[model samples]
Target: MPGLLQNKVAIVTGGGSGIGRATCHRFLQEGARVVVADRNPAGAEETRELMEGNDDNSAVSVVDVSRSNQVQQMVNDTVSRFGRLDILVNGAAILIRTPPLAEVEDVDWDLTMDTNLKGLFYCCKYAIPAMLANGSGSIVNIASMSGVRGVAYGVPYAVSKAGVIHLSKVASAQYASQGIRVNCIAPGGVDTPQMRGSTASAGTFEERNLEHPMGRVGQPEEIANLITWLSSDQASYVSGSTYVIDGGAWAIAT
Candidate 1:
């Protein structure tokens, strides 16, 4: 049987490590040509190396999603190289500081919003037109459980993710007739370098794990699987929705 995304062209932002990297792998395995875009040149190169054996099916672009010019160029480059754009995964984000709301600085909030929310806007602003020309495409944004709940100290992260969720919904509705599907995946406590590097004062790994009813943290691959499905034709009927892959964490109250 042919792969789910055979012949498709995909661009995954922050596609160098953690969930982004895993999603890039999954997209490629499904037979889609992928562009791994990241701010970190080294991480992007690492992802490129990881997909080297796949030949010309993949490429990498160093991009800071927060910059509109860079985002526009990245989209243009993908289309120029691949000839078309079918899928876009906005997975680039940052969690610089997790101070309580009272202590949160303006700079921290601005950085988080610019990267996590505005970045998606920048990508979609440029990418949607390409998808419109193609007459069909899918866009998946990586949201967070914090967006759905009251994350104690992660105010900026939560706010940015919430904006993503709303943006996905609006974009999905606006372009549904144009054959573009937009959705978001809100994951909880996935085992990512960013998560691991969070303030230790927040809690221990075990404590964090127990926060979920599943009694464990999620893996990046698990989230990647959901993204692949969402991007595939199999999810043609799905749009403007947020899938929570939080292991029932949000379903239960602590």
Candidate 2:
């Protein structure tokens, strides 16, 4: 049997660590040519090295998705190298400092919005046109459970993720007829390095886990698995949908 994404071309932003890195690995395991884009040059290089043994179907690019020109070049470089564009996973994001809406500084708000929301906008702005030209594509935007529910001390983060969800929906609606599928994955407490660091500052990691129904945080690979499936043709009929990989966190109202 062939891999799920055999011969597909994929771009995974933030592909240096956590969910982004995991998704990159999953995409490659499924036989897709991957472009691992991240703001951390070293992270991208590490991902590239980790994937070096894989057959000639993967590369990495240092990119700050928040920059429009950089994002445009990232897409252009992918197309130039692979000759086609198919899947785009917007996984690059920053966690806002936990502060009350009134206490959040302008710089913090701007950074959060720029990276979480505007970055997606810039990437889609470039990737969609390529997808349109190809006549078929899948875009998976990584959202957060906070996007759906209000989180204490996470105002900016929640708002930005909410924007991502809505942006993906509107884009999906507008492009469905043109063969481009846009969807989002809203994950709850995932045990990534970033989440661990955030939790360390906010509270105990175990306390965070208790908020979830499963009493455990999700793994990066779990999220990556869903992303891989969503990016595949197997999910052909699924578009404009938000798949929550939160282990039932959103299903409950505490």
Q: Could you give candidate 2's per-residue lDDT for residues 3-85 as a string of tens digits?
A: 99999999999999999999998898898999999999999878877874555798888999999999999999999999999
* Model 2: how far residue 59 lies from native, Å: 0.8
Indicate the TM-score of model 1. 0.96
Judge candidate 1 at residue 24 and give its lDDT: 92
Query: In candidate 1, what are the lDDT values of residues 54-145, reduced to their tens digit?
Result: 57999998999999999999999999999999999999999775678888889999999999999999999999999999999999999888
List the lowest-lDDT window of 10 residues for candidate 1.
197-206
User: Candidate 1: which pairs clash?
Assistant: none
- Assess every candidate by TM-score: 0.96, 0.96
